[model samples]
Structures are given as C-alpha cells and as structure tokens.
Target: MVALHRFVVLTTTLLLTSLAWGETSNPYLPRARLLLEELRYAEAARALDQARAQPGNARDTLLEILELQGVVAGMLQQPAKARTAFQTLLVLAPDYRLKGDYAPRVVTPFFEAKGWVGDKGAALRLEALPTSGADNLLTVQVKPDVLNLGRSVRFHQREAGAGWSEQEQPLTEGKASVARKATRVEWWAELLDERRAVLTSLGSDTSPLGALAPGAISATPAPLPAPAPVSPLPGKQPQVARAPGLPLRTVAYVSLGLAVGAGATGGFLGVRSNQDRARVVGAPVDEAGLTVGLTQREAFALDARARSQARWANILFGVAGAAAIAGGTLWVLGAPVNVSATPAGVVVGGAFP
Candidate 1:
C-alpha cells in the first residue's frame, strides 16, 4: 500500500511538471498568441510551426494562424514571408483585419499583399513626364505609395511586333529618370520580383512627340560650305579686310586678369575678416578688467565691414571665374570665320550673323 501510494505521488508530480513545461515552451496556438503579445516574435513563429503541424485546423484557427504568422514575419523584417502569409490569409478570408492598434509598418505589407491577391486594397498610379528641348531625358513619377520598398520597376519600350524590351532606366523609390536618345516608341513600366517576373504594372505615359517619321530627328540643317576662293583674275592683289567680332583672345586675357585681381582681393578680405574676428575675440578679454582694447562700437563696426567686404569679394570672384571660363573656351576652339569679296575688296568676318 505504501509503495503504490508513493508511485501515484511520483506520477502526479511528473504529469504536473510536463504540463507546466508545455505551457511555457510548447508552440501551441494559445501559447503562440501569448508569445506574440509579449513581443517574442521568434518564439511565436516557432510556436506557429507546432500549430501548422496539426492537420485540418478550423477555418477560424487557420485565419488566426496566418495573421499571427504574418505579423511575426513582418516584425522580424521578413517581408517576403510576411507577404506570403498575408496573401494566404486573404485567400481564406477576403476581409480580415487585425484587432487593436498595430503599426503602419506591419499593416502596410498586409494591404500591399491584399492588393496583390484581390481588388479590395489601395491603388497605385504612375505618372511620366518627358522633358522638352534638346535633352532626351524621361522622368517617371509614381503615386501614391511604393508597393515594394527596394524592388525596382522595370521600364519597357514596346516594339512593333517583337513585344516589349526593357528600357534603359529602372524606376526605384517611385521615380525613374534617365538620359537617352529619344525615339518614336511607346514606353511602359512594370514592378518585378526577384525572378524577373512581372508582379504588377505601373502603366504608361503615351505623350506624342509630333508626327515625325521613325528614326527622324528634327535638327537645324548645316549651312552650305562657303564658296571656295575664286582663282585670282590676273594681277589684282586680294584686298583682305577682316571684320572682328569681339576678339576671343582679348576677352580671355581680360577675364583672366580680372579673375586674378578678384581672387587676390577676396584673399585679402578673408585675411582682414580673420584679423577682425581675432580683434573681437581679444577685445572682450582685454576689456574685461576696467578700460582696455577695442570699444564695443568699434568691434561691431569692424565685424560689419569684414562681412560686407567678404560678400562683395565672393561675388566678384564668381563673376570673374565664369567670364574667364567662357572666354577661354571660345578662344581655344576658335569661332567660325567667314570671308566674302566684293569687286572692290575682300571682307573676313566671324559668324555670318
């Protein structure tokens, strides 16, 4: 009787121990919920595995499992996994929402997944503006939200019969921009996954660039080459008269001189400003003990003068630098020189008009 009683007590203790361990560590649905509530995402995910192992879970139980799994995956920054879980949940329950105030970060992925799965979610739009003028750059903008944060949207140009080929630019962060030779082709965009499969399309902008023939660009025609010099008609010396259009060398030299002068002046002004600052700093210390150094009014005047001179010096330097560069480029390349002759004389000129 004593032995039997002892055996019963031992079994009871063992059973209680097992139950307590299961409550703390087993990945049951209830335990997973508790883990998730405590923000133990990894533990909750592990608990979810246990729940998943059980076959034929109720529809409500499955919904809860998927929602919790998505939440945990999102919290762990596993977007793909979170998206998968949410999509599966959407398949089961078309209208499912988490109870209480969850973060937008976690909730956003759910909505994105919902949009991907069904038609009852947020809508995304694409807007593209092709730049006018000489540059062949295209600017694509997307709204109102980027579906996938880091994934790129492939820009595609449609060909006549060969279908669509990816364009040069990839849109990321809801914007796409690139400089390329413009063509008479239709362009569109698509969001793609890692496998290069199209997830969804961001649509296209079909603004016509006028009715120009394919491969034709509108550009000013080149001026006809100047008539070759006529063979000298026996004995009349060529009377060459040159028309000067702002001598490039002269302009370059003058601009360079001004630049050098302005730079020197700026440097001098900077030194003076530094000197004034030093004086202002020292003035306070020297004047600390009853009557000494610069007066407050004098220090203020010096500071103001220093700032004004510095500002003017910077402006002069910038203007001088720009002028020098422009003039120097013209001088190096040399402008088109045109020459024409009348019966009385020959005239040499720069640019026709």
Candidate 2:
C-alpha cells in the first residue's frame, strides 16, 4: 500500500509540471496583440520584453518584437529609442519595410534611418578638375552640400607600384583637392554613426582625377615641374620673394560658404516663423480646415521657438558677413611681408624697400 501511494504521488507531480510547461512555452504574440488593442502601450512594450526574455523564441518572433517596440516607442514620442530599434531591424534585413497598416509618422522615421544606412539612396556626382596652372594638382568639387554631415569623403590615388596611397580628407563644404605624382586617383565616401562605427560606404565613381572637365576624356599627363627661383636684382636691397598667401583665400572661401549656409538657414527660419504667425492667426484652424490634435499654448510656444531660431539665423548671417568682409580684405592685401630667419628665431618686417 505504501509503494502504491508513492507511485500515485510521483505521477501527480509529473502531470502538474507538464501542464505548467505547456502553458508557459506558448508564444507571447497573443498577449501582446491583446495589450495593443486595449491601448496599454507600456504594458504592450513589457509584453514584448517578456517574449524576448524567453529562451528559444523563433527569429521571426524576435523580429516582430523589435518592430512592435519601434512602433510603441514612436507613439510614445521616444524618437531615439525608436531609431535604435529600427536600426536593429535594418541590420537583420536591410530591405525591410514596415507594414502599411502602421501610421505614417511611425513609418517615416524608419525609412529615414534606413536610407542613412541602406545601400540604395541618392548619390552625388564628384568631379575632378585640374587647376589652370597646377598639373599635379586635382581639385575635387562635390557641389552644393556634403549630403550627410556625419559622413567622411576619402581621396585615394593608385601608386605606380602596387597599392593605393593613403591620403584622405573629410568633405568640408562639398569640396577637396589632392596633389600627387600618381597618374591615377579616385575618391569614395563613408557614413558613420555617432558610435564611430562604419554604417555604410559609397563606392568611388572611378572618374579619374586628371579629367579636365565634366564628361571630358581621361588622360595621364606628366607631373608639372617646380618653377625656377627668380634671381635678385644687383645693388638694390635684396627683395624677398613671395607667393600669394593661400590661407587668405581659404578663409575667404570658407567665409563665403558660411555666408551661404547662414543665409539659407535664415531664409528657412523666416519662413517657419511666418508659418507660426499664420498658425497663430488661425488658432485651432488651418487653411485646410480645423486643426486637430493641437492647442493654443503649444502654438504659441512653437511661435516663440520659431522667433528664437530666426534670431539665431540672423546672428549667424551677421557673423558670415563680417567674416566675408574681413577675409576679402585679407585676401586683397595678402601680399607677402618680409621675414628674416636669424639665429634667434625669426623676425617680421615691412615689405622690401
């Protein structure tokens, strides 16, 4: 009778354990779906977390968790978190697109993130122009803007021996140039996230650096020789030879670029400020009709922000103008001054008498 009792107890324990496992092993999809319907966003997020915590969840199941997490975070106004979640999704499937059922606001940020890291996107045309007087020099122009601020544009040249020369520069104001003896040169760009990890790379267009003009024929010309020094005149004070200061020109160009950038920013801010003014005029209403999901206080705050931005833009424009004027003055007056290197460092003096 004791042995019989022991066998029955053991069987009951095994049955209970089996039932528990059966209930827990099932996926969490149903739970999450129910939570979403109730508009319990936080709870739904927690449900997805629970699903991820479980061992042996299928790949598809995990993917769905990420997707839902992004959607929830976006709805909650957590853009950074949503961006991170979508980034993971893109890593898994580069071409992944969110379902159409999701709202436009939620889906928009996802694609923008994808485009920043994805292979398919608009590419800028890079042209290599040979400067008028300099043969070994190639000026690279990436017109307009650098496309992405966080990206780096690298310039490379193929050596006569075997490999490429390691010389590169970041794309500043969408322009760069390289001087080298190599007959062949090319350029490529890379995109990196804040963590400094390379997210994507754009292949070099293979347009040779020696091409004189856009769509012109490619050619390999000999390296230009250095100009011979001019002889000093006899009897008079030996005049110091001077080349036009390039720093002045760079400052001028950079100032001009800044002016353009600042002007564009100011124009945008002015338009936005006007928009806010219009919104203020039509409180709770837009040109189309009644504006939904917005309040008067919110509109006022936006208008304030727009005003502040416009002010900042104007300040930057002022700085740009001043810098341009200063730079222009310097460039025009950048005739080389006299410098005599002595045993004690160096000394600057007025132009040769």
Candidate 3:
C-alpha cells in the first residue's frame, strides 16, 4: 500500500509539472491580461515586452499585446511609449479599435497616435494600373506618395516556378515601372522603413498579384517583302506570279484549340487554389494559440497544396498565353490573298500578309 501511494504521488507531480511548463511557455499574454485587471500597470508592461519577444505569435496575438502595452504605458504615465505602441498597432491594422472601456488617459494617447498617422499619411498603399496597347510595362502607383516619408518601396517579383527577386526603388515620382518579360508574372510591393522592416504592404507572399504579358495580337506584324520586279515582253503585258505559302490555317486552329483547353484547366485550378487558401485563412485558433478543428500538420499540408495548385495554375496560364500568341501569329502569316487583273489596276482580296 505504501509503494502504490508513492507511485501515485510521483505520477501526479510529474503531470502537474508538465501542465505548468506548457502554460508558462505561452503565458505572457494571459498573465499581462490578469495583471491589467489587478491594476499592476508596470508588471503588465513587462509581460507585454516578454510577449512581443516571443517568436511566432499570430497577428491577432500581436495586436492584443500592442493594445495592452499601450494601455499599460498610458496607466503608468508614459505618454510617448503609449503613443509609439498605439502607432505601431494602427499601422498593422488601420481599422483596429480599442475593445474594453479604458480611462481617458489611455484613450487620449490612442487618438493622438491616430491623428499623427493621418498627418504623416503613413498609410502606405500600392495600386497596379492596367497596361494599354502593346506596352509590356506595369505601372505601380503609391498612394499619398513616399517622397517625403524618407522611405522606399520594395517590389518582389517572380516568374512561374522561379524564386522571387526583389527590387527596391525610391518612389520619388510616386510611381514605379515593372517590366513584364514573362508569360506569367507574380508580384507584390511593400513599404519599407529605414531599417528595412515592413511598415505596410499591398499583397503578400502567399497571395501575389498575377499579370500576363500582352500577346502577339497586340504586336505589329512584320512588313512583307517587296514584290519581284515584273518583266515586260514585246507583246505580252507584265504578269506577276506568286507561290502559295505552306498551309498554316490548320496548325493555327490546332494551337487555338489547345490554348482554349489549357486556359479552362488553369481557371479550374485557380478556383480550387483560392478555396483551399480561404479555408486555411479562416481556420480558428484556440486560447493556446493553436489552430482549432485542424492539427498543425494538417494546416501546413493544406497550405502546401494550395501553393502547389496555384503554381500549376500559373504554369497552365503561361502555356495558354504562348499557344494563343503562336496561333495568332500563324493565322496572320498564313492568310490567303486573291489577285486579279482589272482595267483600273491589280486588285487584291483578303488580308495583306
């Protein structure tokens, strides 16, 4: 009986230790909350610091921590610190609101931070305008301009199946140009501070803007060769002779058919990718900062699958663009022409090669 009791006590001790360790591993945020409720403003501020130092905190977690840090600083009469915390939070989430009922001290600084952000126009936004004609240039405009911000815009671009390449440009003129050299291009822009930290962004790595280069239909056709010099005989009028080019009508039709099929497949895959991405984005997180209803491995697998499908969709779209260009070029080159001698002059029918 003594031995059994000792074993039971040891097991209970070990179990409690394990639970305590698990809680402490991610307890900073919750501890800060409790400290705030108990009016331990200084201790809550320290807890918020620890929480921020912890890596891999979710966006929601960071937001909560920032708000709490701002409140604690305000309660402690640190106006500058409180304003800094609130400003960082506002930059990350422009529409974020303070949840609980706070004293005028806390609310006052938060609103002041809002006004500072507005005055500085710190809300960075990027907009991609549509290209016209056969221009292969993509124009990205920065909202409110960054010339006075003492910051630069960084652009991340990549072709399908290729790694990302970054380009940093100072938006002195409020806009930058990206050359579209590939069939499918993925790109996103970020507003970077002096320390190269991201302040705000338009798109992200997982969700990038895609653009297709203009096809051959928008390109100017090559000029045809000058007609051979006609020889005039004593009694026979000058006659022009031309040999029919290889029949490309059939080949062009086949290429167009393939393009249609590939385009349809790409569209279907893109839809599936978006659906999977939505599911991953909408997954709920529990108090322990873990995704609910799905294991971590399952969530990772879903994300990987979504990325794979998106890549494949981009590849198919590229293939479709190439095929369509080929078909259009062939159709233009193979168009037949009819020539007839008339009293007025020689008349030509059909499209000019």
Computed on alpha carbons, the lDDT of every model, listed in order, comes to 0.60, 0.56, 0.71
Candidate No. with top lDDT = 3
lDDT of 1 by residue, 17-37 (tens): 445433322237776776776
Candidate 2 error regions (>4 Å): 1-105, 108-131, 142-151, 186-202, 205-353
- Models 1 onward score TM values of 0.28, 0.29, 0.40
On residues 214-267, what C-alpha lDDT tens digit does candidate 3 reach at each position?
A: 773434578999999875544544445433535677788999999999999999
Return the lDDT, model 3, position 1.
100
Of the candidates numbered 1 and 2, which has the greater lDDT value?
Answer: 1
Query: Model 2, 206-241: lDDT tens per residue?
Result: 533332333434665768999999744443344354
Highest TM-score scorer = 3
Kindly state the number of residue pairs that clash in model 1.
Answer: 0
Clashing pairs in 1: none
What C-alpha RMSD separates each model from the true structure? 21.5, 18.1, 16.7
Model 1 lDDT-worst window of ten: 283-292
Using lDDT as the yardstick, the better of models 2 and 3 is: 3
